[model samples]
Target chain A: MLYPRFKHFIEQKKMFSLGETLVVGASAGVDSMVLFDLLLKLSHVWKLKLVLVHVNYKLRGEHSDLDEMLVQEKANAASVPFFRFTHTEKSEGNFQEKARTFRRSKMEEVLDQQNAACIALAHHQNDQAETFLLRLLRGTGLKGLGGMKGSSLSKSGKKYIRPLLPFTREEIEAYAEEHKIAYRHDASNDDVSYKRNWIRHEVLQQLKQANPKIVNHLSHLSSQLREDEEALEYYVEAALQKVSISEDFGKCSLKREIYNSLPKAIRLRLSAAVFQKLFLESAILSADHREKIDHIALRKEGGKAQYFLPLNVLFTRDHEKIYFQKENVSE
Target chain B: MLYPRFKHFIEQKKMFSLGETLVVGASAGVDSMVLFDLLLKLSHVWKLKLVLVHVNYKLRGEHSDLDEMLVQEKANAASVPFFRFTHTEKSEGNFQEKARTFRRSKMEEVLDQQNAACIALAHHQNDQAETFLLRLLRGTGLKGLGGMKGSSLSKSGKKYIRPLLPFTREEIEAYAEEHKIAYRHDASNDDVSYKRNWIRHEVLQQLKQANPKIVNHLSHLSSQLREDEEALEYYVEAALQKVSISEDFGKCSLKREIYNSLPKAIRLRLSAAVFQKLFLESAILSADHREKIDHIALRKEGGKAQYFLPLNVLFTRDHEKIYFQKENVSE
Candidate 1:
């Protein structure tokens, strides 16, 4: 069931093109193995050129090597090109973030070498749900709750695709068992980040008791929110265009009438963008800050040039226009 | 601390008018009782005429009556008008839902009798979090995940306000203790709905181990999503205005080019709204349906008519126009 659905998702999302080369990230885990097998089957239909890439952080000593060996053997059996990166550096602070950077850079290296259209990773439904829950727990806004996308481009311009994003872990395991795919157990769970483990083990499992399909629900929510965020970003840009009266160096004035006519969400996003464009000092605005700024901007009079945003951004709203300026300018 | 914040939330949201008569619902639980006390204090400053409404569902027998008595006693102590309703009728068939309906209608009845502006309910932050989590577990969309609003109008044109929405259960309890506000425990937890109990006891409590301030995060997400949903609704309407070529009875034609130019989120929403206006049969479109419909409508020259929505709506797309028509006419 999930096999056909995976193919359908790939087609519907237009994640791949005919004969497009892809750098596939594998951890020898069941999820990745299933993704590999699914893409292997899809290779003929989509004419996809597949290259498997694995990273051995060596944090798990023998376990990491064994995982790499299994993936290499499987790639050889399938006659697929394999790229293996072995990390010899000592593990330091922020293991997960650092490892993520190391792995993505290595994959991009392989991606460039192969001239692949994109890198494909095995981030399945469970992973997305866990990320969403983790973000919700730690506190997040609209964009955070949107979770991961099916296909995204990195800041450096390399594209990545997640064909297995909508498939649940159970479905991946089921697909793996049905095909007798060779995959490793990822015994390195002990070294995995605490927050991810807490979410996957404690939060998600307990929530599964409430609903057997909670992962699917969360995935659905993530997909919906992502679409929503896209729409919001578009509107915010449009609203910015409508409201901006003029933009000079280190300052932008927006027509208060136009800005006030926008929806609350778009108004807030526009304000944030205005600050980012003019000052760039207010890296993040808390909900309270946004509300206060919006209060003054949208208020129908009695508020003038007395509003202040973080650090050195001055907010002034008159009957006609709202002006934001950088107070401190470096020479 | 919560006292001032509570007042601030009400004023910031413009939840009430000066000297406006308000019907507040109290369950004798600490959350509502604290809300009752806060409003009692704010009554003078805001010149609010307060009427406390309590309903004893009698499902918990003696406990329910005790709750009513405690609320009535408190109302008498404050010299505030109190209206108590005792349900002697047999509680059957979805006790919680029925009790909620009965309670709201009774409260509204009193509202009309007193010419009150709106009903103020003591739905605190914990309730919002619990609702959000429970909805997530049971499966929900972006709107469902948005949870409750601070001030909302029911379909019947009556308004309801939740002033304590930003205050957590702990905050409410702490405020109650600080103010020496006497409130009953409601002693009816045993009769509460199973799903709510499961979520409150299992999911949220387990999640709290990961983040003690999870409630605040959930509340924050809800607030942000609510704002997002509002923005989405606004954009959908705006896009509809641009794309709609004609809307006649049981039919609507949209400019396919214009529709495709809009964001995916707004396009999907516009399609749903079109179906609602034209056929009214497709009450809810699943993600799959929306994706399929969108695929057909946006695909260049590949699809012409033959798209079917629920029961009796036909979706058709040509080179320039997307048309929808109701298939059945009962009259």
Candidate 2:
């Protein structure tokens, strides 16, 4: 049985093309399994060429292999293509982030090989809320609090979609049960060592006591912030086009007076954009760093101010202009 | 001794002018008393003519009067002008909101009588965090989550300032204890009947367990939202000026094509501004309402759409223009 709400959501959001090849990031968990089942049902009507893509991280031993096997069996039953990628890279620093990045890269490779239109991920409303809470606790700014986008283009120009984002975990679970879909439960979800798991078990439950609809409220907040962030980004892009004097590899300069006239939010974003243009592709600048650079740009009594950003970029501000360059590079 | 951080904050933010008459709303609570003491100490250095204004809501019997008496006594000892207003009128609904409105009106009256430049209120960081949570649970947009402004001009052109907004409740209490300042604790603060108190005791405490710096994190989030909001408002104001075709006392007609081209956040704000221009002074349209109107405006095949907003105003969109007028008003 097709979940009417999820079907309506996908139709309304135009999450995928009617007859395009698409990749599903399936993990045999309730979230991804439900998504896979729904897409298979919809594919017949929408003329979608469906492909199930699973990543056996091999971190959970036999459990990960079982997850891959289940997804492959379902894909075969539905008469759809199935692809499995084995993750063998040892995670350093944050395990979840590393694993997620690796999964994304592997999925993009499959997307290219299949000539797929986009990849669908099963990040639901609860996942969005968890991301919001995690970012909030980490001292994030507006963009971070906005959480995941429903559809975003990757660096290599591949579109990624989260069709299940509007539905809560409870709703998805109910859909799975009503449809009698079999899914594997990952026990690691309860292991509190994962920061997200800690927040899910300890923090969200406490918040739910105050407001039963806490998850919905948080997701709503994220939507609001996302809208605002997009609006600001539009203006920032316009401002940057006018204020930026010159640009090159690893170096750029912007007019000081014109930049100062923009809003603080726009100024910070403009600085980040420049930093991204200069620094490595995967580098992310903290809000505090962006703010420090903004202050350097806007100071009234500036003679010649200089600061080193976290990404090892030298930011210099003078009376006429602000410049960014590689830290060790000479003028 | 004065608070160095506050002094620097004032200098940086340009919160007040030198040698001006200012009114401080002293409630005799630890937050306000500490503010009172700090202001009294800083007045001589800044050459400020200070007035202490106390509102006795008379809701708590003798406790209300005692609060007034203590504040007045402090004003007398400091040799600063003092004014007291007795709020005897019974509240109708939402007593806190009613009392707050009444107190604000009375303070403006005092300011007019004294020819003061602005009135100061001691709304600290924790109060800000509580407000963010309260508004979040109640479903607010970016503006509400931004929390209170450090300085805002009232509708009547009176300025209200919050100098203690950067400090937390504990910080204020510590300052009060260090200065040997006597302050009365309002028993009403412990009343869970009030939603703000419920959140403070229940929600915030739960959040604190996950992250001890929850209050600071929330306030920081507010600051970020506030900056983003201000930037969006700037663009919205500019957009409204260009889009508005005609305006009357209680009606506004805006160009549909131009309005549709704006960002969603700006579009929603422009709609609310039009609603405010046509409806009651205190009327506020929710983000959901604004979003619905935006959807109606942006529909690809539009004929004619009408929505009855919360403020009893009719929002009409035709092929050429959008109209806002009182519900019963004939076109």
Candidate 3:
């Protein structure tokens, strides 16, 4: 029943193509092991070309190598193609994040080398919930709160899919147990630095008392918000055409009448879009910053209306136009 | 300094006008008491008319009567006119919610009688945070996550203001203590029944270890989402016009081509709005339900492609028009 439902969800979401080469990102964890097993089972039906990829960061010394060996052994036993990458780089600040970047680049490289279609990950509902709670606690907008998608195209135009996304971690664990799938668990991770681990083990557990189905609830909210974000992006794009009169290397100008005429949400989003246009990668715009922009946009417009954002982006309004200009664009 | 900042916030937000009649909802709690004191001080500067209104549900025995007496006594000491409403009705199921409805209607009645500009409540950042968290935990879309506004108009177009929304409970308590303001405390509250109280006292406390500024973050996120929701609503309204082909007595027909062309978020929102139009008030459409609709809309177009939502709303699609009809309209 679970297998059928999982396949159905993947088919309904149009996550992947049958018989296409898929780079499976397995970490020797229960989720990835279960994911690998499911895909192996699925291969008989859909004939999906499975290429198992693992990156051993070697953080846990012997345990890490054993983790890599387990994945390799599974791949060898199943008669599947496998690729392994070792992160020999000296462990430094933000080991998890840096390792993730290294791992993804390596996986994508394999995809390029093997002409594989997309990378398949083992991220599930708990991961989605943890990510949303982390983003929420860290203070993010709709885009961040929207959490992960089951299938998405990356910035490099490469595709990735998470077939296990619709299921919870408990379900995956149950499946792993039922199928007798061997997997390794990372023991004694640094809870302080591994913020997501802390959230998964601590925060979400505590939140469950508030609502027993916190995981599923967060997952549902995130997917709903994801759709919301996609829709909002469309609206933002449409409003950008009307509200923004002109843009340059360091400056974006807008028509206050058009901006104010729109709803408050669009107005704020337009301001954000204009800000993003001026400085491609800017600092965080706090809610207070948005409030200030909302204030000055409508207040008696003149040259006196000038506010500086965190990135030295100067917002100035006049009789004709409201402008956001980067003061030090050369940097 | 707090007073000045508070006044500035009120003025900047355009929360109130000078010398207008304002009905203050006083519950004798610290929040309402502090609010009453603030408005009283403001009246001297702006020559405003302050009418204090308190509702006693009479559930807490003589303590409830004492709460009323204290509010009336403070109003008398300040020489401000007051109105007190006693909940003479028997206490029944969902006492808090029913009490709130009864209280608000009575307050609004006062506003109508005195031609008051707005009913001022003492909802602060904490209230905003709780509402957002509750909604988020309960699995809500962006609209629910937007939470409450600082100032808004009711269905009847009567204005209500939350002047202290920018401040936290700690700040309010500090101000109350500094000013030697006396306030009542609800001695015993049922943590099980009072969901917000449980969230306020327990859930929020647990979340603070993850982030100390959780309340403020939730408030900021809600405000940001408020803008996002408003913007999405505008887009939904726009898309609603283009996609929804026509509406009849108990049915709405949409264009499959148009609905499929729009982003996933708008399609879901459009579906909710259409459902609202047909049934007036309907049960929730889950994310799964939305996925099904999204599937049917773009899938093979025929009479066979039909989905029934909660409350007997039938969704069917053909080549040109997709229809949503209330199956049990007579009920």
B253-297: candidate 3 lDDT, tens digit per residue: 877778888888778777887777656775567767877887788
Highest-scoring model, DockQ: 1
Which tens-of-lDDT digit does each residue in A21-63 have in candidate 1? 9889999999888888889989988888899999998877888
Q: After superposition, how far is residue A81 of candidate 3 from its true place, in Å?
A: 1.8
* Positional deviation of residue B169's Cα in model 2 after best superposition, in angstroms: 1.5
For candidate 3, what is the DockQ? 0.74
List DockQ, one per candidate, in order. 0.83, 0.60, 0.74
Candidate 3 residue-wise lDDT, A224-302, digit = tens: 7887888777777887776444445567777877766777776777788777765775555665777788788877635
- Model 1, CA-based lDDT: 0.83
Kindly give the stretch of ten consecutive residues in candidate 1 chain A with the minimal lDDT sum: A242-251
Error of 1 at A12 (Å): 2.5
Candidate order by TM-score, decreasing, is: 1, 3, 2
What value does the interface RMSD of model 2 take? Answer: 1.9
Residue A260, candidate 2: C-alpha displacement in angstroms: 4.3
Per-residue lDDT over A1-331 for candidate 2, one digit per residue giving the tens place of the 0 to 100 score:
2467777878777778789999999999999999988888888888999888898889789898899899989989998888888888785697777888888998898889999999999998899888888887777778888867778898888899988888889988998999899999999999987778977888778677668998988987897789888899888778767645344446678888888888887888888877775676667778878888887887788589998887667889977888887755455
